[model samples]
Target: MCHSQDRTPSEVGRDLVQWFLENQRDLPWRRDYSPYGVWVSEIMLQQTQVAAVVPYYLRWMKRFPDVPSLAAATEDEVLLYWEGLGYYSRARNLLKAARLVMERFGGRVPDTEADLRVLPGVGPYTASAILSLAYNRDVPVVDGNVERVAARLLDLDVSAKSPEGRREVLRAATQWLVPGKARFYNQALMELGAVICTPAHPKCLACPVAARCLALRHGTVENRPVRSPRPRWEELRVAIGVLRENGKIYIQKRPEGGLFAGLWEFPGGKALEAETPRVALVREMEEELGVRVKIVDKIGVVRHAYTRFRVTLHAYRCVPDPPGQIVRPRACAAWKWVRPSELDLFAFPAANRRLIQALRKAADAGS
Candidate 1:
């Protein structure tokens, strides 16, 4: 109900920076503080939790240490390193942007906001994060955590993702950051939100800026960082086939620029309302691979969600018919036949990975 004009920006900034320096988590990206590290970490962190990103980051940095290394790698190999991290497009874009960095920016992560924004998948928040965190620019990075912190501290009247709300947060950040301390200041604000000023059950007592938070003073801490209503989940029934011949499974690399673009997936499609999953798998196999398959057994089912749709995937173990077992690939960028144990050579979507686990489990049990 009350606006956030009571506390001075400098006072809050001093407390946040001091607290963050002493409390920031020991993350891999923080250890090196290189622009390449910051860029990779920021992109990997998108729509993914920090805990989940750590291992992936470690592996990625090991494999592709610099922009040139990343640029040299093939897209499939890049996605292989980024397999479990959902949002396949992030991996794809990272590869594209890495090549662009090599071609356009002379193998350096762009320092200016404009140049950074032009990279594939680099948006306002990402650009700001790179500039401030890597280049020490006096720019603000207002991600979800920072938005939540700013909304509570500044008592934003609109949703944090809204344009006006972002402007309000940037205005507050511009006034608060100390000279030559943009990196620490931005990290502190985000770290505070991550650990102390959490979305639910915030530790107001532990928060260094608790005394200055207008939302806390007004008893609106729980409802401060208002967000728009999330879109309804669209339910889908998907059927995928783990078609095997001579002990190796068949998988397809999807063509560029569609749902799950360029990622590997088992052959199959949506099940009609009246048809069972087996029927759908058989139909898809005949249609896509130019062969008829016999549904040998049920492998497993996986549930996955994208931004707007949730899918219950049914995975079936299938083998081509004895006589007409010739495979002719269709509607795919590429196709591969590899042993189940050798599946790590290619990248697959989340559901397919789960299917692989179930496949292994079944094989183990059978043996």
Candidate 2:
């Protein structure tokens, strides 16, 4: 890779800013430029595609609109808005942060990176982004897109997944940051990476800073930003018990602070190596809900993939052994017996959503 330091960072920054002003996408977040909007958009954009987040962002803005509204919302309501977004913890943290901002910051999103970092789930990248974009602070952001751009622009040969590699990329981004033009500069760099300097096939012909890109000069843009190997996904078999009594289905809320936090789902758990789906359902019900269940029949299997693992959910229709014994939640946060028609009122995981649809279809056929 070539490191021709002929052009100054200021010159490169100016060119990128000019390019951004002309070619940037007309996103809804860009229209408002409010701190709340930027914070929500950045959170949603993490580990998700821009196209996927747009409608969600719009609906969320319409619903919550600002810090106080979000802070005042119940966890269930917040999770409802975030349904199908997959990562439930993001919504939980956003709610927590909103409440903290209301209590500590007087309902205003913090302006400085340090102040913003105190909020739950607000890391360096998010804090820097909110600061730079919303407050117009002269800070640099090094998200995946910006990291890729930096790797090619400076021809950094380090694997961005490594600690040293990440630090180097951040340093390069900071070094090239245009003071007083941070909002445009940061967005421009990220936009360039997203559209032009993409990972798979970068459009070098359209890149404004292509003239200054070291990876382009060295003909290694395709492989400039190296990544470490990702861990293999673990497969697990789960048994979900669809407990029904007097026309209401039993559902429980997941505990806060983990994957799918605070979302509603049918009671179930991973099957032990020696246990069948029915056996697992019996054990899971007794342990999780403190109630014995008699599995009536198999409902069907549903497969779902999470970020770290894949699960094959074996669902079964079950009845309380004692026939209307009080269903108590021993492991989860809460439990409810809701009419099947009321399932849509609660937010459930994607896998559970599929299960609900299947359950409804089965009920319809039986009726």
Quote each prediction's TM-score.
0.96, 0.92
- Best lDDT goes to which candidate? 2
Give the Cα lDDT of each candidate: 0.87, 0.89
For model 2, how does the per-residue alpha-carbon lDDT over 43-157 read when each residue is reduced to its tens digit? Answer: 9999889999999999999999999999999999999999988888889899999999999999999998788999988998999999999988999988888888888887877
lDDT of candidate 2 at residue 333, scale 0 to 100: 84
Separate clash counts for every candidate: 0, 0
Overlapping backbone residue pairs in candidate 2 total: 0
Q: Which residue pairs in candidate 1 have backbone atoms (N, alpha carbon, C) closer than 3 angstroms, thus clashing?
A: none
What's model 1's overall lDDT? 0.87
lDDT of 2 at 346: 97
Query: What lDDT tens digits, residue by residue, belong to model 1 across residues 1-367?
Result: 3285676777778878899899999999998689989999999998888999999999999999999999999988998999989888888999899999999999988898889989999998899899899888887777788889989988786887787887788788888887788899999988988888888899999999887788888888888898789989999998998888877888899999987788889999999999998898889888998989888888778998888999999988888886447799889999988888788788888888888888778779989
**Clashing residue pairs in candidate 2, if any?**
none
Question: Where does candidate 2 have its weakest 10-residue lDDT segment?
Answer: 1-10
Name model 2 segments beyond 4 Å from true. Answer: 1-4, 361-367
